[model samples]
Target: MSSGIMKRRPLKAADDKVHDFLTTGIGRVKALIRGSVKGFAKEHRPRSKNGRTAKAIFAEAQSPTDEDGNEIMIQVKKLSKIYGRRPEEALALLREGKDKGEVQSMTSNNVGLYDVSFDIRKGEMFVLMGLSGSGKSTLERCMNRLIEPTSGQVFIDGLDFTSLNDEDLRIARREKMSMVFQNFGLLPHRNVKDNVAYGLEIQGIPESERLERAVASIELVGLAGYGDRMPSDLSGGMKQRVGLARALATDPDILFMDEAFSALDPLIRGDMQDELIRIQSELGKTVIFVTHDLDEALKLGDRIALMKDGRIVQIGTAEEILQNPADEYVDRFVKEVDRSKILTANLFMRKPKNILYETQGPRTALRMMDNCDRDDMLVIDGEKRLIGMARSDGILRAMNAGDRDISGIVSDVPSVRPDTPMSEVVQIMVTTDFPIPVADDDGILLGMISPSAAAETLRNGGGE
Candidate 1:
């Protein structure tokens, strides 16, 4: 009877504590809302879907061509571009090696591209990247039936251009696709306006319409005043701009760029890459951009098709290919990309859950929180979407909110998703003045994954 009495007393005492916690915690949260909402609304009124007020916040990049406007899709079918002495014998030896489980050999000279295949979806920035002599350039040229392949099919906009007659191929190039070379290939005799207008000229466009299109293209390339200047009078970067303008002037559905910025200095190269991305965002054409630079590929490629020995070793989104490379060669190509620039918010959005912030008094919430080891306590409304975050440590601050220095006790923190690439997590963790909320597909709270946690996740490929 005595032991039963003692147990009953402790249980009764604990019940009273929990009861106080609930009532007081709710009061404190109500107080926080009362204090912050008005001030927050006054200072930084919440943005709407298109950056307006009184609604949600959602925005997307600008694209000039709608889904129907750009339609020249490219698909490479078992592409092989081999050029060297005794190609047939070399191929035979390679086949023999494969049969003998020795797929690589020392005495091989036919290195451009060997039996590669992949597709460039319409209105996608399909980047082909590899080291020098990886046949990236050759493979790109072969797509538009520019370079004659040794023994593979080149399909453009669903037509097998490799098997097409010269007249048909010429018509296709003129009407459907345009090429940009490493050298500007501008006519020295003509000014920038004429150089840009040359493609339309070849296609029998009237000079009046061609010049108008040329001027627009020159402005598009950011070479407005230089339309009257000759190619020799321009710098290397400017000359490349001239080349890009020429390609754009043709108004072809597909654009093939071959090492177009490799000749410029590093700063100029970066600028050109930015310009290309901005233009690509605006034009939304099916771009097959060839380059040996991995960083450049990451910056521009919607889907990076990493090529090796003339074959597409891997094909995926920049994140997919970088995070889960198909093999050793592809892995090495994307090992050093600075990932923060490409991280998107949707990647961190987690599945929705039934978590709600209990509006409790500071002391009560702090005492309750002290009994656990959770990184954070999510505060949600009736909808269960993220409203705010309450840190485990923040409970203590909220409790001591009376202290003048603890004015900013409750603040905003970010959260992330389970499958989010760690790169985005790191950016939010480093840049934002808060912790990240890790969630699932439906905006459900899945606990917090910190920057350190994210880095470790990447080191182990989201395992362990």
Candidate 2:
């Protein structure tokens, strides 16, 4: 009884901590409701049933087009999958305007996925997210034909995937794509090195080359010294590392991860998520990750596809989803996500109205500021490089002292890259003046972000 009580006490204390944390977070979110609600009310526009799909809405803004060499890695057109009855019969019932449950009841066919279509570009971290039984897993399986799609076309690099024969499909899976599961899927009989090498062995790679690749993959997943470790000797996180190492050993262009970090304890899961992000940054491999955790989706996904009842309800970048939810369902789903972490400067920056060139005089700087109804102006060089800032009083003082150029009065200003998250930007805003310069890597001024704008974005969720 004492032992049981000890365990229960710790668990109970942990639960209390979590409850307190959530309560504080909720309070902060509620405090922003007045501003966010007003912003949402102003920006919100109702959509028709035939509105453009998520891909179309975010195409030019979020995902790059073909002109940028972002070729479609995975394309699904009118894809549908059914279980129980023949596909044709199931498809017939679907076309007759019958719903999934209705078709299942009438024809004894379960509609796993229905009319799903999207194109994943190369080098993108595309996430499929939904609650359980929402067809998120089924859609992922159909992508690689692990579960053969009943109908509709799937194209990889413009090659039709659904039309491939068994042997061709096998080869494609071996060379083009690799899958990681929630379960570690390691072989108990094989050591870590041998398990990772399993894929290369199946491809008939020579022993010397396979071992070399296996060791490289093992190191890639941060398990370099554990090559000889048995699966039974490893923790849940370590076993998953072995699984990831195996997937990487194949050196496939695409990775399909089905709830890959879902099984770990929270701390371990966070570590793995960071590891995957670092790996993705270094390798830039196309990845399709499936998760029911919205926070994970927001953190890892370049673009997210939210599924409901086998239909894709919406698709967008994290900011897009938070700012413009497709419906009440999506709005509720994003309510708890910490917006400060996900919203970045790229989405919230405003155009700078008052700017002075290096060659311009202090009088010119003061004139520009006045015309824009401001006290200060950002100054840039002839090459469009951001130098600093010049306030009206500083410029006038310099002018009175016989200074000809605005450079004489320019003061160092706080600046942020276009990709800086609002979490950092918030701190900078409090210390700096309004309209912090948003510059590029080369120090070129692109735009500015004001305190009100930043607060509005946080309060309103995300917007202009």
Candidate 3:
């Protein structure tokens, strides 16, 4: 009887606390608290007619586009989530120049997110990164409507997700997106095949079709022969692979992975990260990955959103973030990161100033190299495609021999792609000659990476 009373006592105290806050106005208190609970519960409940109608949240603003002009897949605009009985008061305080800590201290309200806005491009691997309490997970949940936002909008491929009716949202989740959680959420009693096919089963897919899709997904994740094994029989990494296969089985356009590989051992985690990169490259799926590890984010993200105190402090590629940190906080956050791995050849490469045409005479090549004060000049063909290097000695020899064109004097030189890592570039520079040519797939000379430029970039921890 006493234990029962003890458990009920906490509930009674909670009611009393609500009653005390009711002095502010019973209707307002009830509405705010009830709405918060209902909104959260509505995420998992069946279709409800009470869900809000869609609105044109981005009608006044332009939708963001990628560098390749790819359409935006996910756009979050001024999204916020405040958890408290007096959320309105907390929100008011937040808007009046108060930080999350200050607002929480004043009103005892936890501000999970505040004014978060960003656009994720289609087929981009976008990362949300921060410390434990920085609200990265909260932001991800808000984007997917797992946790209802206090205010603002989320647009999925131009469709407003926030205003979606329960049935529409559920259907959208089923068809347009899927999530991979940190902890493997496999059903304990189900075999690997059944677990992978769970999403298809939910959609009432034919049993044979779902099983076929599940087997393909399993094979894709490198778990081909483990279909009959239960979740309990799999190792941790294998379990994670099963989880990934399950998410991929549905073939969702957008994959929301929240700290998905944080649980595995270091070696296994690295393998999973590599596998994810390969898979993403092959599938070209838009991934919104959440992580606290800066290295992991730097390695995987096409662009990263760094959050602090429930707000995005910065958003950029790894090189951009490392080279040009937005603020002191961001600077500190990336201070210890290995720049060699993050910096690329394209970032530090210089324009090819002493370029010689392959059709030009040896004298012309020599003159150009002299003008640029360079020992060697990069020779290009008629189409501006890189041919090779023309050293001063080679040009001089060719001129002495009365050669009509510098093409014969041009020698094959080691070259690297623009996206090559700085570490590999440095190694090439060490083993080969200075002023390595940076070229594209078609051998078009994009730029040059000089030894001095590489040295300075490494020393200063940035690029030109």
Candidate 4:
């Protein structure tokens, strides 16, 4: 027989037998798998080649530096999910250069995702965004295996998530990641504290410890005293906070939020979005958020992947997508975005014409400020971290006061990071007389956003 005929004949012959077995004996197979997992666990838990447990591997991956110098926390390679009995045939059609619609038309398989590939870096808020049926939610579910993909691989912390068995996958889900859904999945019977502690309870954590963590998480979500109340007693926004608290209580390495704020009122939705941003900034957790709202995606995503027809149409920062869209569709998608809200301070900030060191004397500081034709100068310390701002009047006074250095006269100035949106930058600019210093997280001076620069950028509708 020919090779293709030989393969097809056996598959056809076994199809009936396999169907009969599945119809009657699938429960036994599940039991056997569970028993095997238990026996294996009793013998020895699975470990990586480096001898680290799953928890250890995921924990170490949270560090900024990786041993192999790879900073990616999650890598999805050519992931596709098809819904149909003949998914294999559909996949073959897909690989043969058929689009999702064409493949569905040919094989009657709905393509949920198509050759989707992306990487999420550690401590980054990565958003998958598109309209309904664009495969954004399907992609998120595939990453976590809530909806198993028809083909391709997902790697979390260098471990192949798709290849993991049931026991290992359960452990990874409990220890490495958590998800928040659109519907607040809080148990109506359970009080707020118990709802938040549900995951830890599943892990068989001691009650006291889990409750303590739950309480802390409640406080983190700003629902401090509501832990004793039932979910039904809270408002829509408060209930969502409980859901967020439940996910955060586990302190998972990755947080997957699928339309997390979509169910709330518009005002509450905005508030929740802000809360998420504040929490993400404080925790620095890797977040994979899914949303259909462009404004929410732009506000929350450090980088966004825009999907269309089961494939990603573009991947970039909000400013990048707005300024340089990949195709006509992407351009049309972002054509109506408010540029001021999307543009960041770094886009328009200029290098400081004159900077003063803390060790510099008043006379030297004043001279530099005069030469630059400026009334203020940013002062930095020995390590080039921002100290404060020194005004020309302060320097002049310091000169007469016989001060040794300009450090004593330096006054605290409001500062912002380069990634701060220009809308916020303009707000800060109006409140302060001096230009706002743009500093990095380490407080190192990067540049300055002057009033004129901010106004000009805003006037030109977010400059090039």
Clashes of 3: 0
- Give the Cα lDDT of each candidate: 0.70, 0.84, 0.87, 0.87
Give each model's clash number. 30, 1, 0, 0
For model 1, where is the 10-residue window of minimal lDDT? 53-62
Q: Which of 2 and 3 is the better model by TM-score?
A: 3
Instruction: Give Cα distance to truth, residue 300, candidate 4, Å.
Output: 0.7
Best of the two (2, 4) by TM-score = 4
Please identify which of the two predictions, 1 or 2, would achieve the higher lDDT against the true structure.
2
lDDT of 2: 0.84
Query: Which segments of model 2 are wrong by more than 4 Å?
Result: 1-69, 336-464
Please give, for residues 1-464, the per-residue lDDT of candidate 3 as tens digits: 99999999999999999987876587687869976875565233222245321223223445567677878989899999999898889989989999988998999999999999989999999999999999999999998899999999998877778997777677677767889999999999899999999988776566667889999999999999999999999899999999999999989888999999999998999999999999999999999999988989999999999999999999999999999999998998886454544777898898988688999998777777778788877889999899998889998898999999988888898999987877788878888766899999999999999898778766865432
TM-score of each: 0.55, 0.59, 0.61, 0.61
lDDT of 1 at 375: 46
Candidate 2 residue-wise lDDT, 1-464, digit = tens:
99999989999999999999999899789859955775555432222234432233223333234656777788888999888857689789888988888887888888899999998989899999988889999999999998988888887777777887766676677777898999988888999999999888877676667889999999999998999889999999999989988998998889999999999898999999999999999998999999999989989999999998788999999889888999877887776444544778877788876688978987777777778899978889998899998888898898899887878778898899987877678778888767888999999989888888788766865431
| Residue range 1-464, candidate 1, lDDT tens digits | 99999989999999999999988999799969967764554333222223331111111212233255654367677776656665566556655644112323444545456667766678788888887777788888777767788777866656566886665566567656788888867889999999999888766666667889999999999999898888999999999999999999988888999988888899999999999999999998888888888878888898887877656678888789878999987766565443443443344344433233545555555554556545455565444555566665766766665533222344555666665666657666667644477755776665655455555546655331
TM-score of 2: 0.59
lDDT of 4 by residue, 1-464 (tens): 69999899889889988998897698688868977875655333233334434575455444333456748889899999999999999988888899988987898899999898988888889999988999999999999999999999998877788998876677788878999999988899999999999988866666667889999999999999998899999999999999999999989989999999999999999999999999999998999999988889899999999999899999999989888999987877776455544778898788876899999999888888878898988899999899998888889899999999998998998899888878788888888888899999999998998888988877977443
* Residue 363 Cα positional deviation in candidate 2, in Å, after optimal superposition: 73
